[model samples]
Structure formats: structure tokens, C-alpha cells
Target: MWKKKTKQFMSAGSETKQTLHENLAFTAVEQYKLIRANLDFTLPADEKCPVIGITSAMRGEGKSTTAVNLSYVFAEKGSRVLLIDGDLRRPSIAKKLDIDNTHGLTDLLRGKGARIEDFQSKRRDNWYVLPSGAIPPNPSELLGSDRMANVLRQLREMFDYIIIDLPPLNLVSDAISVSPLISGMIVVIREDHTEKKELEKCLRQLQMANVRVLGCVMNGVKTGSASKYARYKYYGNSSRGTGK
Candidate 1:
């Protein structure tokens, strides 16, 4: 099991990157690498351009951080990865990654007359980000719209992996709306924060929706929190099946 990563809740912009670099424990990095390996093993081999969604049962469970770091790890091998700010209601990727949100996923989903690439800003070599754009009046409607499908279709041809940072499942259905679009979803659960009931309910929701849930990632773990240490060790050994 990984130890509690200090300051896991990162600051905005460049500070986010700095905090991540400063605070990410060796165990945490290895855990994420293992997560990538597990996903690579579990995801259908035929799906070349996998679209993975990152979400949580409730807010502030480090879903965005997971998405960003996962994207970072995915791109480490020169794989083209695009991290999209799918949480249109309360966008975070732009602030977290310090990218522009002037026009992005929301814009493309609203039928904006422009190429999808026009809205995306490259964050690094082979890494790009499509921000949430202006906050939409009806995020669910836009996410479930035909334009969203079109945008994804276009994105598939461009990137090896598309990581979408979605809103909390318990808070809204925005995550559910995009469920059909993703190859699979990973639920982020924070230690000492996410309740067992909430996790059960989240699994029920995913089961009911028939979302191809990959599994849950345990976040904010404490090094010496006894059962939490044991629980995270369990997660490390059997990550993809632990939550369910």
C-alpha cells in the first residue's frame, strides 16, 4: 500500500505541477504505474484508441489529479494522450494544468464551427488538453449530444489515449452521461473521506448504467492508518476488482 502523499490536493497552474513533483511519494508513482499496467492488461486489446474516464463517488477525491498524473504517465512512453476537461459544470483541468479554457470540449460539443484541433492546446510533446471551455447552461445535454460523439470520433484519429476528468457521480449524472462514450471508467476514492455507503451506491449506479467500470483508485492514503494501510495494500494487489 502507498503512504499518504503530502499535499495531494494540489494548487492551480504551475503550482500544481510543482506540488505534484514535490509531494508524490515513490510508492504513489509506482502505484500509478501499476494502475497503468493493470488497465493495459484489463482493457480490451482490440480498442486501440481507448477513452478512459476518471471520476469519484463524491467531490474532491483527487479524480482530476489522477486523470492528470495518469495522462502524464501514459504520455511518458511517447504515447499521444489528451486529457479533456469533461466536467463542464465546474471545470478544473484548465486551472490545474494552466491551460486555456476559452474554447474546448464544451465548445466542440455545442456545435462550434471549427476543427476539434483548433480548440485543443498542446501541453507537451505528444500531450494535449481540451479544456471545458465556457461553463455551459446544460452540461448533461451537451455531453450527451451528437456533437460530443462527433468530437470523440475526431479525437480518436488523433490520440492514442483520451483521459476525461469527469464530475463526481454522487453529485450529478454528468459522469454517467459520458459513460457510454468511454471505453471504461475508474472511480477515485479518498482515504478517510469517501464513505463505504457512497462507494456501494456508486457501484450500484455504475452497475445499473452498465458502465464498463475498470475499478477504483484509492487516494489520500495514510502511511500508518492501520486498516487504511491494509486496505490500500489490498487495492495494490487487486486494484481493478477491490472496489466492486
Candidate 2:
């Protein structure tokens, strides 16, 4: 059996560059590359555009950070990647990436005659972002709407990988509503802060919804004398099934 590993979470402030892709350390970059490789191994060979959702059980578990870093790594591999801020209630991708959120996913879904290209903001040669524009009053309804599905379908035709930074599962039903549309989900869990009971509840919810969970990313684990030192490694090994 393959054992899971934990790595020291790279603090966003330590990097002089605003985004991880700009000035990420070798270890930190390798960690995300491992995640990307793991994700690729889990994806179906027939699937052209694998849409992955990154979420956590609660707030402050580094879901958005994982999503951003994973997207960056995928784009770095020369694949056309689209990172969408699916967390409409509390959007952060735009601010984190230093891009304008005036128009994006919500705007495109509203059917206000905005082109998809108009909403997409390119940060790199292969990476594009669709921010959660203008928070709506009914986020759940909007996420579950048919318009959202249509938008995803269109996006699938354009990008090789679509990464969605979703809201925490326990916080709201938004993540659940959009779960069915994604190819798979990656759960982000804080090392010491995330409760086991809460994590169980979140996993149960995903199971009840029949969502495919790729695996869990244990974040913010301290690297100290007491640590076991399970080094981050990416072998591109085939997965027997989802959920680790």
C-alpha cells in the first residue's frame, strides 16, 4: 500500500514575488508538481479537459492556494490551463493573482452578452483565469444553474485542464452543487487545525453526492525534530482508485 506524505506549507509572504509561480522555491515547486502528476495519473485517458475542484472542510485550510499552485504547475508543463474562482461568496483568485475581477464567471453566466474571452484574463502563456465577478445574492442557485453547466462545457472545449478554487464544503452547499460538474476533487486539510470529525463529515458529504475525490493534501504541517520526514515525491504511478 502507498502511504500518504505531508510537506511543509510554503508561506505566501516569504516569496518576494506575489504569486508562487513567479518565485517559488525548489521544494515548494516540486510539491505542487507532485500534486499535478498525481492528478494527471488519476484522470481518465479519454478525458480531454480534466476539471478539478480544490476544496477544504472549513476556512483557512489553503484550498485556494492549492488550486492556484496546481494550476500554475499544470500550465508550466505547457498545457493550456484555466483557473476559475468558483467561490462566488468570497472570491479571492483575482486579488491573489493581481488581476481585475470586474468581469468573469458570474458575468459570463449572467448572459449579459459578455464573450468568454472577455472574461478570461491571461497571466502566462498557457494559464488563464476567470474570477468570480460580482458576488450574487443566491450563490447556490447560481452555481447549480444550467448556465453554469453551459459555461463549463464551453471551457472544456478551450483548456486542457480546468482548476476551480471552490468554497469549503462544510461552510455552504455551493461546493456540493458544483461537485457533479467536476472530473474530481482534491481536499485540502490543515495539519493540526482541521478536525478529524469535521473531515469525516465532509468526506461523507462528498460520498453522499457521489463525487470522485482524487486525494487529500495535508497542508501547514510543521517541519521539525519530531517530524517523520515523508519527502514529497511524484512518480506518475497509476492509481487504483480515487480517495487517499
Candidate 3:
């Protein structure tokens, strides 16, 4: 049943990547549902509106895609999900979602008396997006500021799930600075692009910061077919999977 649903959701190649649109394939939806389930199982039961950070070992590993899709699936399941473009260094949620990027995280954290509602943009009935706003010169400092924490706290009261798309772990320290505030972090790795050594170093950095490693999403797994259903596999903390 699940397989059939997934096949219905996903059609072929690039089309399967349209998880943000209304015509998202069932395959993409199913994959995100699997990720959401894994996240639910990984987080503490007491944590509410849990802020989950989606990151990768390096750039182009599909962290933003994972974050957006995960938030879409959660909102589809009736949970109010807020997708935050925490990757201030290179924001893409606005462009990918085709929404307004006039204001967002940086604006809210700038301490200019900006409110959360002022920067937030709704993508769906229950799904919202907060773009990275204007790229700041000091992304690390802004992300680590007390204002950022306050923004998150305020968001938790209004959202059931706050999915943050952060910069790659190996590229910068921005993710590490924001790690302590999130409930857990999901590492996305491309099967062909991410090297084993790089993935190890990424995990080590997260470990040193005491970031809760929820699990990993193995992305870009080729099945020797031109199918649009990209293979995605999840592994929990106790049984982390090895990257290519």
C-alpha cells in the first residue's frame, strides 16, 4: 500500500523533486513521511513544537529540499509546521517555494523591534515559511544571538513543528551555533557526492557541540533506472549509516 502510494506521488526524474508544489508526486510525499516518522521516534516525547535542523556535510546535499518536504508532510498531516530558512549564508527557501523573501530570520533577529508575524509568510493553510531575509555580514553572530533564541521561543508557541534549513556542517560554524537550541538535527548525505571522511568530520563537529543527532537521510541513491523516485533511507542514532 505504501509503495503504491509512493509511486503515485512520484513520476520521473526532476518531476519527482517538486515536493513544494501542489502537484507533488506521491513518492516524494511518502519519503518525507518516512523522515517525519523517524524524527518523531527520535525526539523526546515531552518536546513540543520541536525545532529540527536539517543540514548536510557539504553544499548541494539536499538539506533545504529535505527541510521543505518534511515541513510539507507535517503540515499535510494537520500539524502547523514552520519552515525556517536558517541558512543565512545562502537562502533558498523563498526561491524554491516561490514566496516572498522581503523579510525573515535576520530581520527578526536584527533587534529592530520586528515581530515574528512581520517576517513570516504562509505557504499553505498550516505550513509557513521564514526566508533567511537579507544576507547578513555576520550570519554566525546573528544566529547565535539571544534575539534568535527569543524568536524561536515565540515560534514554538504558535507552531507544532519548526523545521530549520541550515548551512552545511563542513562549510561553516553557523549550524553549530544554532544546534544547541534545536531539538535534534537530521543530516542529509548524497550517496554519490558526500565522501565518507567529510561525513565523519561533519558528525564529529556536531558531536563536539553536543547537538542531538536524530538520524540520517541517504539521498540521491540511484536504482539504475530513469525513475523519478529517488531512493531515501533513514537510520536512527544508534545505527547511523555510512556515507559514500
Q: Which candidate gets the maximum TM-score versus the true structure?
A: 3
TM-score-sorted candidate list, best first? 3, 2, 1
Q: State how far residue 30 of model 3 sits from its true place (Å).
A: 0.9
Query: Per-residue lDDT for 36-79 in model 2, tens only?
Result: 87777778878989998888899988788778788988988999
Off by over 4 Å in 3: 1-24, 113-115, 118-123, 224-226, 238-244
C-alpha RMSD for every candidate: 6.6, 7.7, 6.7
- Cα lDDT of all candidates, in order? 0.74, 0.76, 0.77
If both were scored by TM-score, which would come out higher, candidate 1 or candidate 3?
A: 3
Candidate 3, residues 1-244, lDDT tens digits: the string is 1112122223323433354434545665576787777777667778879999999999998898788778888888898888899999889876676555667777778765546554334345677777887899998888888888988998899999999999999999999998878888999998889999999999999998999888898877775544455466677773233322
TM-scores of the models, in the order given: 0.83, 0.84, 0.85
Considering only N, C-alpha and C atoms within 3 Å, which residue pairs clash in candidate 1?
none
**Clashing residue pairs, backbone N/CA/C < 3 A, model 2:** none
Candidate 1: lDDT of 108?
A: 72
The list of candidate 1 runs beyond 4 A from truth reads 1-23, 113-123, 224-244
Query: Distance from true position, residue 197, model 1, in Å?
Result: 0.9
Stretches of candidate 2 exceeding 4 Å from the true structure: 1-19, 119-122, 224-244
Q: TM-score of model 1 relative to the true fold?
A: 0.83
lDDT of 1 by residue, 144-224 (tens): 777788889888999999999999998899889988888888888988899999999998999899988786788776666
Comparing 1 with 3 on lDDT, the higher-scoring candidate is 3
